[model samples]
Target: MKEQFAVDVLICGAGAAGLMLAIDLARRGISFRLIEKAAQPFHGSRGKGIQPRTQEIFEDIGILDRIVAAGGVYPPERLYHNDGSYSDADVMERGKPTSAEPYHLPLMVPQFLTERVMRERLMELGQIPEFSCELVDFVQDADGVTAQLAGKGGEETLRVRWLVGADGGRSLVRHSLGIGFPGKTLGVRALVVDAVITGLSRDYWHRFNDGDMTRQISLCPLAGTHLFQIQGPVPLEGDIELTAEALTTLVAQRTGRDDIQVQSLSWTSLYTMNARLADHYRMDRVFLVGDAAHIHPPTGGQGLNTSVQDAYNLGWKLAAVIQGAPEALLDSYEQERRPVAASMLGLATRLLEAQKHGNMRRGREVHQLDIGYPESTLSQEQPERLDGLSAGDRAPDALIRGAAGHPSRLFNLYKGPHWTLLGYGLDRDAVPSRAGLHIHTFGPHGDVIDEQGHFYEAYEPAMGDWILVRPDGYVGAIVTHENLHALERYLLQVGLGVPGVFNG
Candidate 1:
């Protein structure tokens, strides 16, 4: 007898990664089940920094305005000395927004708030995560994955085409797959808590230290809330209880100020810094995502953002494969994302080391705007193409004039779950039209006019240039008009030929 399938994908852990994957799949009209072992939504202020790249993603998903409203820019750090003097320092260098990059600075939305926004969005898409539902075990063969789930209703069995593990650092799915996560743990451990406090101004992030890294204590005011997230190093010698009174004593002992008090505690956790990456991201029909695939120190605020991007990168490919795209397309997920995650882990580890030595200044690298799949198999360009915006690079956004004379952004054209093809200096009638593909021509006589030449400035496209952008907003292929057949062949190879045919 043939195996029965309940859903196309079964996603474990409704954190940033799982939630994102669910949202993307839902928007694309793919069937999926998002499950979480936790009964309630996360309420911690962990992973509060939303990088600019992630902001762009939220914009594409129609949640940027909500995120912006719920968060604010990072406040300047106020360093307090032992003599009672304080000096204000910029925590990160803020950059002006450009046409190519709209969000320049990182936004400070607590992890709980970010997850809340995504959950709300998911609900709007007609799916609510199955809270307290845990994937106890799953076995995969060539056709599908059979998973045993435990929840309030009791144990149940279901089959899915793909099983994705977005469960965090201690991922049962990963452990069940027997993938090796090899890395080292740093020497520092810190206590993090969210509490209401008095005697400190909310305008700045207050830091107290007397030239000792282990003695550092910082309190950052959570945006859009009255709570302050307090963090201090855990002493190696003592067993410190995680309680309001213990935190109050800790603040007093670290700052030597009796005025500042932890009146109430909302959330608390002990954070240990470690950097680890899974030996393999995929095993047969099961895949690991986010912290399941990699985990590192949260020094540069790269953890949550990278995890969201991981889902974003895999989401479209999974949808495509389910809707008749080549199975090989899914292979690019690990090939493209694992290296990026590795690089991000390195950056976070370095930042943690720098923080230990008192160098807390963050630079543009943490923004994650420059990350791309330059070496991926999906990225294709002409052999002669050298300096211009190469394939595998992120497609830059630009302002353009629509046929109705209305001003619009390039991202608006690339927003949906479809491939976008840009034909520069080519006749509108010459471009081929196909289902699941949006084609636009640009020049003196075209569908969209580059009124201010912003598109030209960003892309630097030559006459008769054809740029094919993937559903995930990366340049997939670039070719000249004379070689348009190359674009067609590339599309066919990726299984974009037939409509409504799920070859897989």
Candidate 2:
């Protein structure tokens, strides 16, 4: 019997990860349903930092400008000592923007504002998240997945090709799958709140501590809003109220200042840090993403950014498989992303330790620009050509002049939902052409001129080197004319090349 499917993908959350996946799938014209157990969008100012790598992802998804407008750069920190003295410190090590790396600094936008921007983009693409809709239970077979959803009306069964669990740490979908999320819960608890604070300048992130890391308190002004995100340690012996009055008292006591007061709180929660990773990212047609797959401490601001990139990595693979690509393409998602998540988890934990030891310095590692998939099966490069930007590395941006003498960027050319082929110093006719592949040649008398040799300098390609960039902006393969056939074979294996058809 042929199975009937309701949608191609069923996304079981509406936070950053699910919303990002929804937006990506919608833009690709993939039929999907994004559901959230909460009736409204997330309102807290959690996960406020957007890393530079995620900024690049936002650029590719057509939301970078809106995000930039809604967010601001991280402000310098103003640390107040117990003796009525204060000092200024850098929030993070600042970096200058180069041609290859445009967005070098992390943007400060509250999680709610980020979600709002992504939801608006999703609506523009003709899909709204189904709120108050919960996935009760799901059963997946070789053919497809049968999802039982509970919403306002009642229980409804939905059949979909794939089930994605973007639900957070207490993910119902992941729990239902019985995937073991094994890790330790740190003995750390803090009360995080979004409150209207008075008597504090919004020029800097205010930190209050009496030379004890465990007693630290911070009130950071939230970008795009007049509220401040206040965080203070929760006493181990006492049960503290989460009301605005309680927060006000805590702030006054911690800072030993009568001037600063929490006028009111819109949101508050006791956050317990945990470091956990799923035993498996995928089980059959069911997949885990973001916090469902891994959870990190609120250190280095890696959680939300990592979650957004997880969805970005999986979105294109899902779209491809649904559109007659090989199912093997889906397998690469877990193989490639799980390692990155694990690495980031360790980094976040280390950063948290540094915070506990009174070391609050953040560096380039938190920006996530150096992450890559060099060890994955999808990354292919000649051993001799591995000195420079090798396969699986991020494809850097460079300015170029088009045939009509118009200025453009490599990133601008690679914006859409397609693979990009950069033929360096190669004839246009020799560049393989395909329906879903965008090809551009750079050199003398080529399709586009690398005007200032930025492309040549960045890539350092030989006379006939060809670079294949994946949809998620990672270099897929690097080959020369001698092994150009390897490129076709690689594409066919990844379901990008048409069977029995060769363009080169």
Candidate 3:
């Protein structure tokens, strides 16, 4: 496998999105390579929350249990004004877990842990990121992309059918392509310090904001450790000189953890964020995902989750393109994920504006919208029913059974790069006609998975009678095979997922 070779896909910036894309591609048995500029993988705790939809994605990739075992799930958030406490709910409605499914709630793992899990998963699937190998530049043509790779030995190039920049907000790939990222800088600096504590604060995360000022503090729980950060309104020209001592004072003042000892300081830095998106996620043969496409303030902690979700959306499309599915499938990547990035950018923007308002009023107002998407037309046959179930918006959680006839949930089937088909209609065995689709049938209570095998457990009559899910873990469409042609249109629109075997 070593040579001046050509591949199907080339991924830049082997962080969250890059690794996710790599892993998903590997699961689908696609030929690909992921490259990163760092000498080694990132080990610091950065972004600190995972939305429910994202959890469903990791689960599908066969790593959510490890993530949960690593303690990636952040507990419910505890919020307060400068004076009194208000809610421990997720502020985004992901706080409460329903009683039926395997994963009823969202996890709060740190960004670094999330990265480690994604990286490990990629390794498991057999693609190690070429560390110390940076994409100096890339050349794209009508047929493929040739990316210049550089390391200690100078430079070499590898040609691939498609190129993706998951590099970072300051993406070299984006810069090389001369694409413009449009957005505003907050000037407000977030002073972050991660340390191991003896007696850390009890609350998961807290924000102290009254009428005029805002100081946001968060505690991220790992398997046996905690990483904490204190953020507030700082002048646009904040200096780097204020290090551990200053951040320690802020945390002590906010969380009332004066007695808690900072046994070991892990990392510290000031990161100012921008609420911006690329003018376009795609530019000819080169495309962008994650921060390279958009960046947002760390308000609701959507950074890593959004990027990982972006990979879930794009991976299958990329795989489809490689498998001779259709170029149209690739087109929908920007169409679908750009809106998601826009929605995330909107939420972060409003929260930043709310912080400027200096009141809890706007903060609460902006935080309440259920930021989710509806099902795509490509795979399923049930739109109205899916729309009723949160469909493509953000996936809703419900308990069901696994392929083994044991107790499981809908979100768990999301573990791979394939589409998840939940069949409950009269044609329980009739899933989408796609070849690579991961279809699961729940007799009712969904299904379950253990060390033994997958099985159907019980039944939840309230959920849509039947549904076809996308790789990103949202419903693709629901069907009793009604209009049938509607399914064909969706299949053509998204590409790749052969509506019937003949197309494959």
Model 3 per-residue lDDT at 327: 75
TM-score of 1: 0.97
Each prediction's RMSD to truth: 1.6, 2.0, 5.7
Q: Write the per-residue lDDT of candidate 3 for residues 112-213, one digit (tens) a residue.
A: 777887888878878788889888877888888888899868898888888989999899988888888888887766666666655545455555443344
Candidate 1's displacement at residue 131, Å, is 0.5
- Candidate 2 residues lying further than 4 Å off, grouped into runs, are 499-504
* Span of 10 residues, lowest total lDDT, candidate 3: 451-460
Tens-digit lDDT track for model 1 on 1-504? 966679999999999999999999999999999999999888999989999999988988889999999989899999998899989989989789888888789999999999999999999999999999999998888899999999999999999999999999999999999999999887778888999999899999999993476678999999988999998778655677877787888889889898898889999898777899999999978999999999998899999999999999999889888887889888898999999999999999988878877778898999998888989989887644878788988888998989889999999999977888899989866755667788899977788989898899988899999998887888999999888777777887677655434322
Ranking by TM-score: 1, 2, 3
lDDT per prediction? 0.89, 0.88, 0.65
The best candidate in terms of lDDT: 1
lDDT, candidate 2, at 418:
84
* Residue 477 lDDT in candidate 1: 93
What residue pairs clash in candidate 2, if any at all?
none
TM per candidate comes to 0.97, 0.97, 0.79
How many clashing pairs in candidate 2?
0
